[model samples]
Target: MMSRLRITEIFYSLQGEARSVGWPTVFIRLTGCPLRCSYCDTTYAFQGGEWLSLDEILRQVASYDCRHVCVTGGEPLAQKACAELLTKLCDAGYAVSLETSGALDISVADTRVSRVMDLKTPSSGEVSKNDYTNIEHLQEQDQVKFVIADRADYDWSCAQVSEHDLTSRCEVLYSPVQGKLAPRQLADWILADHLPVRMQVQMHKLLWGDKPGH
Candidate 1:
C-alpha cells in the first residue's frame, strides 16, 4: 500500500452530494482518474497534484475540526493509500465517507466509512467502466448515485435499480446533470414512476456557482 497519496485539494465544505448533504465536512480531493467522463467538472484533478503522507492528510483533516470527512477525487481509489487513509480517519472517530466513481474495487475500503458509489450512465461516455461487482459490496450505510443527463439516462438508471433491488440494499440517489436535464422534469419522472430513489441537486453549486475549492 502507498504511504502517500497525490492530492488535488483539501478544504472544508458542506457535503455536496449523497445522503449527508448540507453537513459541514472536510473534503480531501485526490488527483488522477483513469476515465474521462464528458460531464466531469473536476478535470483539473486529472493531472497535477501534491503528494501527502497519510499522517499529514489526517492532520490536515483534523485541523478543520469537522466531524464529517469526505474522501473524494478524480477517483480517490486510484491511489493505493486511499484505503489506508479511510481506515485511519475512522479510527480517529470522524464520520468518514467515500465518493468513488464505481469503476474501482470498493471492497478494500474501511467498513466504518460510508461509501457513495456512482454508476456511470451512457451520457458520461465512461459507462463501460462501471464495475457491476461493486453493487454486491454495498452495505446498508452505503449509497448509489446516478448522474442522469436525459430521459434515456434516467430510464437506464431505473432499470439498474430494479435489476439490483438497489433501494433494498441501500440508499439510491438520482441527480440531474445541471443544464442537460431540468431538475423539475427529473423530479416529475421520479414521482411518476414512484422510483425508490432520492433526487438531489448539487447544493454547493447553488451556493458557490462552480467556485473551485468551496
Candidate 2:
C-alpha cells in the first residue's frame, strides 16, 4: 500500500549474473541496506537517493520499453515500500525479478516476481544475517547465489547446496567475488565435486568494470 520509495537509479542494462544473464533488462535499484558484505559493489547506494512515488517509478521503467525488469538494492527489501513497488511493477506487465540479500523475510513479496536471493557466504562478513528459513519459500523460478571469495567460502557454499538440496529447490548460482577468487578456481571446484549448480560472472561488471549506474 506504500506509495513511494527511495531509489538510487533506474537504468537499462544487460541482466548481469542470473539465469536471464546477457539479456537486456531494466534495473531499478532501491536505496539502503542493513548488511554490508565484504565484496559489496554498490556502496554508493547505501545513502542519498531520490525519493519517488510508485507512479513516477513506473513511468521511468515504461520509458525503457523493456520487458525484463530487475528490482535490486543496497538491499531493496530494507525499504518497507519495496514489496508494493514490486507488485505494482508486475501489475504493469513487465517480467519482474527481485535481487535481494538473504537477510530479509521474503514472505511478503508478490508471487509474480522471480527472486534472485543471495546467500551470504563466510567471507561476506554478514553470514550470520542470512535467513536460512527463506529456503522454504523458493520456487524453481527463483535463484540462490553464493558469491565465493576463497576456498573456505566455496566449501561452505557446497555444503549449503547439499544440506538444503538447493539445486532441486531452485537454480543455484556460484560466482567468484571480483578480484578475490578467480573464475577458473571456482569452476574447477564445481567440476571436481560434480555440484549441480550454475557458474557465472557478472556480465555488467565485465562490460562496465565497477562503474555505478550501469
Candidate 3:
C-alpha cells in the first residue's frame, strides 16, 4: 500500500502567528508529535486522523485558491512523507512554509519552502529534543521561534540568540505561553533586555480564544 500522511485537521484561515501573520493561508495540521511542550495547545492532534495522499492534500489546499500554505503539525516531520509533501507544494507554485518543532532534520525540505522552526526553551519540557544543527540550515527566509513561559525561558532564548548570532541568520520571534506568561510581562521582558527579536501574540487566540483548528 502506498503510504499517506495522517492528518489531524485541514482548514483555511488567516495566518495567526509567525512572520506571515495576518495573511490568508491554508493550514495542514498533521497528526502526532514526539515532544510534549509544557504549554502545548494542540494535544488533540497527538492521535486520530484521516490518512491522505500527497496529491489529495494538495488538491484540498488548491481548492482554497490561496497562494500561501502552511504545513504544520503535531510535528509534521514525524511523518516520513512530509518532506515530499513540502516539495510538491513548492513545485505547484504555492508559497509554502513549514512549521516544525526544531527536533528534526530539515535539510531535505525544499529550499523554496520557508521553515519556521520552534526552538524549545527550558520551560517547554522538550528542550533536550531540539536539534541544534537545524540552526545551520536557516536562511533569511526562515525563522526561529521561542515560546517563553517564564523568565528562565526568556534568558535561555536570549543566550541562544546571541550564541547563534541568530539575528543574522533569520527572523527570531518571542511569544508568551498563553495563560502562563502574561503577554505584557513577556513584552516588558523583551523590551527590558532590548532583545533584537519580534514579540508576538497568537492573533487567533486573541481573536477566537484558542478554538480548535483556528
- Arranged by TM-score with the best first, the candidates are 1, 2, 3
Each model's lDDT: 0.94, 0.92, 0.93
Model 2, 1-214: lDDT tens digits are 5489999999998998888898899999999999989899999999999999999999999999899999998999999889998999889899989999889998778988899999999999999999999999998899999999999999899899989999899999999998998899999999998888999999888899988888
Q: For candidate 2, give the lDDT.
A: 0.92
Name the regions of candidate 3 deviating beyond 4 angstroms. Answer: 1-3
Q: Which residues of candidate 2, in runs, are more than 4 Å off?
A: none
- Superior candidate under lDDT, 1 versus 3: 1
Each model's backbone clash number: 0, 0, 0
Question: Residue 177 in candidate 2 has what lDDT?
Answer: 93
Better of 2 and 3 by TM-score: 2
Q: Would you estimate the TM-scores of all the predictions?
A: 0.98, 0.98, 0.97
Clashes counted in candidate 3 amount to 0
Cα deviation in Å at residue 193, candidate 3? 1.9
